[model samples]
Target: MNTKWWKEAVVYEIYPISFKDSNGDGIGDLRGIISKLDYLQNLGVDVIWMCPIYQSPGQDNGYDISDHYGIKPQFGTMHDFDELLKEAHARGLKIMMDLVLNHTSDQHPWFIESKSSKSSPKRDYYIWRDSKKGLSPNNWESYFGGSVWEPDEKTGQSYLHLYSKYQPDLNWQNEEMIHELYKMIRWWLKKGVDGFRFDAIAHIVKAKGLPDADNPKHLPVVQAYQFFSNLEHVHTLLRKLNEEVLMECDIMTVGETSGLGPEQALEYVGDERHELNMVFQFEHMTLDSPSTGTSRWESRSWTLLELKKIMSRWQTTLHNKGWNANYLGNHDQPRQVSRFGNDTEYRVESAKMLATFFLTLEGTPYIYQGEEIGMTNASFQQIGDYRDIETLNFFELAKTKQMPEDKTMAAIHAKSRDNARTPMQWDASEHAGFSDAEPWIKVNDNYKDINVEAAIQDPDSIYHYYRKLLALRKQHKVIVYGEYKLMLPLDPDLYVYTRTLAEECLLVILNFSHDTIEFEWPDQLAYEARELLIGNYEEVPEERKEGMLLRPYEARVYMF
Candidate 1:
């Protein structure tokens, strides 16, 4: 395996709309990020992966790009972006921009031209076809809801959008479109971006003839990912990108690889392949989601054994051939602490425990904004409180299906993307000190108890624990380059793993439940030879005589 800066570094993800708000505009911007550079540096993060800041219609919260070369006016001008880049680089931090190539906003000039008429010069820039017997081109479902194909009366054709109607899927088959995209990518690299997080890159190449799926959703439309994911030509286009734009500079690239297993992930980021530096796998994210449901909005229960199985599978499978990007949650998912940890009674302990799980694993761990301070999911009672297009569309769909309104709203409250978009909590002020004005989205009610201001003051806060974890990663090479071996693979209440490099070894043990659990030291491992590195407990146990007794949600890392 190649040893790269990205492999040993920790990344911080910033959802621009919720990170911070400058000028009281109620939306986060480049200047706001610049203002918090010191905070990020203090967290010991090496790179910042910011969500899309490109000019957009805001239909999908900046995912629907209308102009790739320009910055959104709400985020400030090009000058602001340049200054942010300079300031971040000065602090020895790299910036990774979100690159959305699978789709573009319907308002984009190319999409507008493509929809103008079938004879337009840009007609082939987007996927368009005549309806089949007054129906969509295929039985594909949009991620939000309804058919993936949106009808265009002017051209009498339907344009494909795997996500929202406002976001039309681009035609990767078109040589002209691919050339233009490559040019746009080069423009950003020349402007000094250190890396890119390719958005939905797996869906770029649909199967030949856009075949129908086996109808997993069981609705009128089916989940068509089997036809679009892991296409052979995607590797070809990515290699072309690596040669044309990525290899020219020492930049990192991580693709959003959805609906893929560990075996499939090797093809994209293997050391032998000149594709991406790493890939974000979604198997772990879907562990808590229902395996057979039309929507993931419903509440589902998951076990420690299940989580361990999936995570250890990836760690062991990709240890040599490829790299892994470890993250418990991101912008599209609910808050990590609320979802994976005990957010009620043992909130702080569980938060730290979850942190230990990701940081101690052999991968590049990403810390989402406010995750260090243990910020949690937003509390919204009614459906009207949400602004996400997917949430609103799903609510409407639930109503049409005659589902209980209360049940639908409850699921939305539990799993909506908006839960993660709530504005950052800087202090205990009215708007969590994010802005003097009301935020675009409601601040989480728990911000008063959980904010950056409070975390910094306390030396043992989650923020400081994360800082220690990052420092440990820097101080110990075994944590970054070591081979992983999962212990207690069938343990129902505890997750235990060891990372070993040469003579050095680090043991990470996490208790995932509210009750205390007793663990017997394995006979193969030496007991007294280990030294405690860090733990969630305020004080390390003085005695190391017998079997281990872990308190509720306690995490311990030992070096031997």
Candidate 2:
């Protein structure tokens, strides 16, 4: 039995930059997170997976780390981080730092030295290839829409950077570099961090000899990423890291594995494999992208059937052999309520429904900050309001391609990572109470109505529903360990599933659409005497015996 505490744990992801600001510097600092420890404890999350807080050049919004050991001055001193860690542990909440092991900022000492001389001891620390006639080693495109190669001014050679040029990929073949990362991990473990979430880990192991992706220009960058992501050697390195560093402590590890499916995910998370605790797959996240190779920029209308199938496949495929890291939205994605649910009139109901679907499923649920308050997209009209490196790079690409302005802006509004990076709306005060001064980016315009203060005042807000749902999750062990079975999988509007564990059976019914529909249980699921656990609407004393009319985006959980 996988009786690990992490399996039953629910995590709250904190994008520190947008969480809160204590120094009134228009940016969230470590001290701000310390102030919110009680709020997070009351919210009922077991772990806090904070996004990158290391010293960075900010080219990729802190993902580009200039120093792994130092804390960013904008965030706070290392002393502040120690206080925050101490405060969180006192409240029984664990800290999980986001570690970017695949790469480091070009300003990093190692990278600086590596680029300084070809004969430098750390010259092999990064992937460098000789350019022929000013041409790159491969035609691979970075995730931020440019060639992965950046030429050195002194030498005609180029180095590889999978995301941004400022963030160069590390050569995993360097045993010394790997040991340095392991040493860094041990340093944090000694400092008492509970766990880690590896960023873009699958990209660490590149294809042998730095081969060019086949016809990269004809395919979406995501399609090209598959050629380098999840290679077999990645498993070897993960095994070494697990046996050498992570296994030394009781820590939870999750890897950001892009474009991997259920079978491939099992390779990383299978307990016997000793690689990682779980992995974050991107199959479901990419469903809305154009299938003909426009990448994630061009959004397409996706059906509920598609979502259910993708989610269920992951849930069932990894049921017993491996674990799952369940998450609907995170720092790199758009807001949950805006992306998946009706964020306008039925925002509360739909957000609750989506929460019901996410939390009740089999795995650790990671609730992004402000998701409880049902935050919507930032909807930044002009490119100037955007701050994410990926979005800005895409904007430049759109101009070079001469894409329509309205279309480009619309794509940015819907798909920009900035949509999730907006300042948290704590109240209706200036800058949504995130800071006393101007924020690094503009706050969402709807803060007057969607702020946390308003949500807390309303009993039926998404925040309260999430709190109630979390309480219910704690009360029932079945919700954590039950086997998931999708019912009426073909239904377009309703997502019905049953979680069974020993004598406990939980029936979860979610109405995804805005239209009300009476749903009767299919004959396959035998009727049993059950009590309503929780729902979006007010509780009714009368029991629902056979079937009931579900309101627009209504949700219900029943225990039999």
Candidate 3:
């Protein structure tokens, strides 16, 4: 396995808009992130992944970029960004910027010119097509809902927008556009930024002929990713990106790739492929999502066996070919503990169990903001509480389907993207100490009990557990370079795995249930444990005997 700086690093993702508010503006800025550097340094994370802070219209939050070279006024000035880079580097932390390349805000200069007229010089900068039989060029649907093509009144044509109408798809086929993008990337690298997290990378390449999605009527527009994701020329584009700007610097790159399986993932992230260091896939994220086409709001119960198979397959397949970016939640998904673990009865233990499972796996683990303190999903009562465009659009779609208001609201509360967008809880004061002024969005009500101030003071808090887990990853090389193997793969609620590198082997046992379970020690490698490196319980039985009983949500990492 490769032993690069990023390979051995633990990345912490910060949604800048909600991370902190230094000026009490109700919005998090670069200065706010700067104020929390020491806190992150002490947490022992090596890389800080900052979400988009570029100039945007705020339609889709920061994803709708109006200027790639300029910083958003809400996020502070370019001077603040420079200071942030310098300060983070001084603290031994690298920063990765979010790169939104698949589309640009409709207000961007290039798009504006393209929409001016068909004869405009920049008409090809974006994908533009004439109306087909008085309808959209194709039946392609927007990820947010409805048709992908939007009418351009001035040009008498339609523009492709796979996401929100405000975010127009860029034409990668335009060589001039690609050249300018590379130039922009080089400019950032020249400014000493570490790397990038490419957004919606898989959707950059559309299939030939702008094909319609299969059974389009039976699937939600979000699931219609089949029409746009993992197309033939994506690999070529990635290689070109790597050769043009990426290879010029020593930095890390992770792609937000959807609609990819284990086999296809290896092609993009293979060590010698020159594409990307790693790619984030959504198979695990959608495990609990109902199989229905129209609504992703409804949640369906998932079995432990199903979870194990999905996780283990990725672990084993990518062991030798490529690296993995292990994560359960991000700015685009709901809280990890609330969705996968018992957030009520065994919140701390289950959170610790999940950490043990992912942190110890053969991958670079990423921690979303507030995840260390066991932050949960926002308990929204009304649809008005949501600030995410995706959530609001889905609610509108639900109403159009004639779904009852109560039922639609229930689904919104359960699966809304706003669940992860709430302001970070820093303390027990008003607005969870995120801001004295009213926050742009509502804060989670449990912030008083789950704030960082409380977590840091409690020695056994989930925050401290996370600190220890990160420390272990840096202290031991096996956790980063070891081979992974799933043990007791068929267990309904018990998740057990082993990591081995040469003569050293570590066993990770996690009971992901609300009841105590008995675990029979494996006889294949009959040996006593050398040390109990970490566990959530007050006392873990030191006796290495057969049929050991594990407490509810118990997680233990044993070295032998």
Instruction: Compare the candidates by TM-score and give the number of the best one.
Output: 1
Tell me each candidate's TM-score: 0.98, 0.98, 0.98
The lDDT of each candidate is 0.90, 0.90, 0.89
Worst 10 residues of 3 by lDDT: 215-224
**Candidate 3 structure quality by residue, lDDT tens digits, 94-143:** 99999999999998999988888898888999999888779778777787
Model 2: residues with Cα > 4 Å off, grouped in runs:
216-223, 524-528, 539-545
Tens digits of per-residue lDDT for model 1 on 1-560? 46899999899999998898888889888899999999999999999999999999899999999999899999999999999999999999999999999999999999988888899999999999889999888898788877899998887899999999999999999999999999999999999999999999989998889977787546678877788888989999999989887899988889998988888999998888989989999987887788976578866899999999899889999998889999998999988988999888998999999999999898899999888999888869867678999889888989898999888887887788998899999999999999888888889888889999999999999999999999999999999999999899888999999999989989898999999898777676788897889999997655455667899999999898
Backbone Cα, N, C clashes tallied per candidate = 0, 0, 0
Once fitted onto the true fold, the runs of candidate 1 whose alpha carbons sit more than 4 angstroms away are 215-219
